[model samples]
Target: MITRHFIDVPRTDGSARRVHYRRCGQGQPLLMIHQSPRSSAEYAAVMQAWGAHFTCIAPDTPGFGQSEPLAGTPDINDFADALIDLMDALGLERCPAYGFHSGGIILVTALKRHPQRFTGMAVGGYAIWTPAEMAIFGESYLPPFQPSAYGEHLTWLWNRMLEQSWFFPWFDVRGEARLPGAHADVARVDQAVREMLESGDAYRAGYGAVLRAPRDIPAADAVVPPVLISAYFGDPLQAHIDRLGPLPAGWQAQKVDTPADHHQASLDWLLALPPVPAAGLVETPHEGFAHVVSAGFDGLVHWRGAVGETATVPAPGGAISLITGAGIDPPGHGLSDDWPAAAPTDRTVWDAVFAEVQRLRGFAGFDFEPITAGDPHHLYPDLTPDRFGSHLTRAWSVVRAGAFFRPRHQPSAANAIAFDSTAIAPDRLAAKHLALLQARSARAYHAAYGRTDGP
Candidate 1:
């Protein structure tokens, strides 16, 4: 089974840094580096496939996911050193490394400086940028992705990732370098958007470093570990193979027709080699903390939830999603990081959040009601009494503990309650959701019609 974890690495500045990683299988230790603005979550499927043959460790590169970002605007070498630090912390002396896109840049640079640390390497889409290309990317690619009042940045991010294949660099206007792989799958785009939100503007730090870093392809007779570079036809970097002149004696480059073929080829190449038996990194259970742009809020949410999707509790009448001022489907309650520090206290803000959620889920007909999150235990960073003390808080606690004091009468199974992963833990904190929703729904019903009778 694939397990998720975090390890505390000692930083050069004498500060402890947390690096999050996903691990599975029990063969050789193979370090997997994912592209920037993405986390170890990207390699879950890859780990599942490759785990039987090798111990896969995919980290959420610095500044992305739950892993801590660098102290400042670090360059490629800093990023590479951070990775090497991760290796050292894990006690991996020498092992093959695999990287993708931006990850390829870090691995290549790391291998160059410390060739003795790796046995073999497989890279997908190693970028060899021209000055003009770099200039273009530097100007438009890694823009600061901060949250806006109306969630405008989200619109840009979704389009940016979706249109990346439509136009090679995504921001290009002339339709040059158009890719055949452009897609519009909401779920696919949603995942990347959530990761980017976790990264916030820090993506500029990690991703920009790779794009601006110098590239040095090893010479034909250069003494280094075996390396294989491959890119699928649809990947823009496939064209860069020609840019690499005079590969080293142990280097091999190939252009595959598809990503699956590319992945399979890389796997075959690695499996043919002898195993790398290295001790696994010390593991710590994930604390279920991550960030996402959800409900018009850009900030920390707890207990592992994805953006733009809630559990699809199918009710023939459709779902009625419960959102609150605070609590895990949290909006107010002091947990959400809002730049303007807006609260959903106003009906207008709740309406705007509902609209944004609709856009994210990419569907309509679902209903929404804003409830008061009176339960203090449901909040994180712990809401202070001075800030949130009120009748609602005290009253909600009574409603939660008292089973008979349900707010809404028993709605038919035809009506399933839904809440964003942040507002409520999908499974662990589900009971709180039930009590909170029942009370709030019943209260709304009681207010509307002086009666709490069952349907």
Candidate 2:
């Protein structure tokens, strides 16, 4: 069942702020924080699915939805405090949460100061900014709210909204903008606008709060909790994605095609992750990529491809590998090699994996320096051929089983035993191996190097 209601939550600054909340299902609590220019209403569909497994609670922060704005309107830190207050008001000791854009920044604040208050977090489109990137975002972040009496504000708002819809890297307006045809679902767009209009001051407060808020989330990576990042196309949060770089320890970022898809993807991710154990040894990878299934690891799921390509799957148990395009020389002459040191510093496991496959296919290697970036576990299937085969299979087993191995010391369980093929004993091992290889073979290929076109 789903229920929506309004409750007053106290702010850190001694004011009562109104909070609009939607509750559904009954289980471990899951809180969702909405992005700016959006309210909790955006999560309606998502809460329904997530409610099946969790007691979903989505709240409009102080300045959004039915919520009253903070009196003095403090920064994001103050907003974070209000969210925490909402949790306390509801008698929640701890909760898991999902946030996007500005909301992600707010949660990062909560995680940093009140780590124990959260069970886990799923952050979508976290904006980590480079100096130049921040400069660009600063320009786009807040276009004059109520444009000076001239219709200039309205024009900018209309074009900005429409143009932002296009894929990012908005370079030239060489082409005209594209909006859904008349036959398209006008209702959704109307609904979005209606919410914006009805909110009145809520809109101003929220947008203004966002504008005045600090451009960066302090100690973002240091916030300790199982974090999953879902970044989609046209996501204004790309700056956050870029700033994350290889991602900090215990954090993972996945790239998706759009924001709407993140709810389900994030839910699946949260459900798949096991919570942290209180005592028993907790294993974490020191180096290299390993498929992880825990709240602590980031889910690097990505959605990328041209139309009409094969659908990709998440690597089983969250394992990843080095996959590269074909035509690269094998581990010598600047080509991919078997050992790590043999590979160039620029090359990543993805390139190394790609090089390995190409070597198997008898392709000539090229002098390509690898650009290794830790893709969220979710992106593994799209980028790696074997997804969860032997190469990744060995790595995943170790991480899950929590057994430390020689040559590398970390708490990783061994799934290699389960993955091994005996050809044929009492167990149709050869058949199992054949099936595994076949699935992987479908993904192993050499395509245009460096560009994320598709399979």
Whole-model Cα lDDT of every candidate shown, in order: 0.63, 0.49
Which parts of model 2 have CA positions greater than 4 angstroms off?
Answer: 11-15, 136-140, 143-160, 167-185, 201-205, 208-223, 234-240, 257-261, 272-455
Best by TM-score: 1
- Put down candidate 2 lDDT per residue, 1-455, tens digits, no spaces: 45555555655567555566766776677878887767787887888877878777888777666566776757766777778888777777777888877778788778777888887788887765557655654575554353122223323433334344552423324344232221223334433433443353346556655555554543444646678888776555643566665544667777776656776678877776554322111111111112212222211121122223222222212111112222222222111112323222332444545433333333343333332122222212321322112232332332323222321223245312233323223123222222222222112121113223321
The prediction achieving the highest lDDT against the true structure is 1
Task: Indicate the worst ten consecutive residues by lDDT in candidate 2.
Answer: 279-288
| C-alpha TM-score for every candidate | 0.66, 0.51
RMSD to the true structure for each prediction, in A, is 15.0, 24.4
What C-alpha lDDT does candidate 2 achieve relative to the native structure? 0.49
Candidate 1 stretches with Cα past 4 Å from truth are 284-455
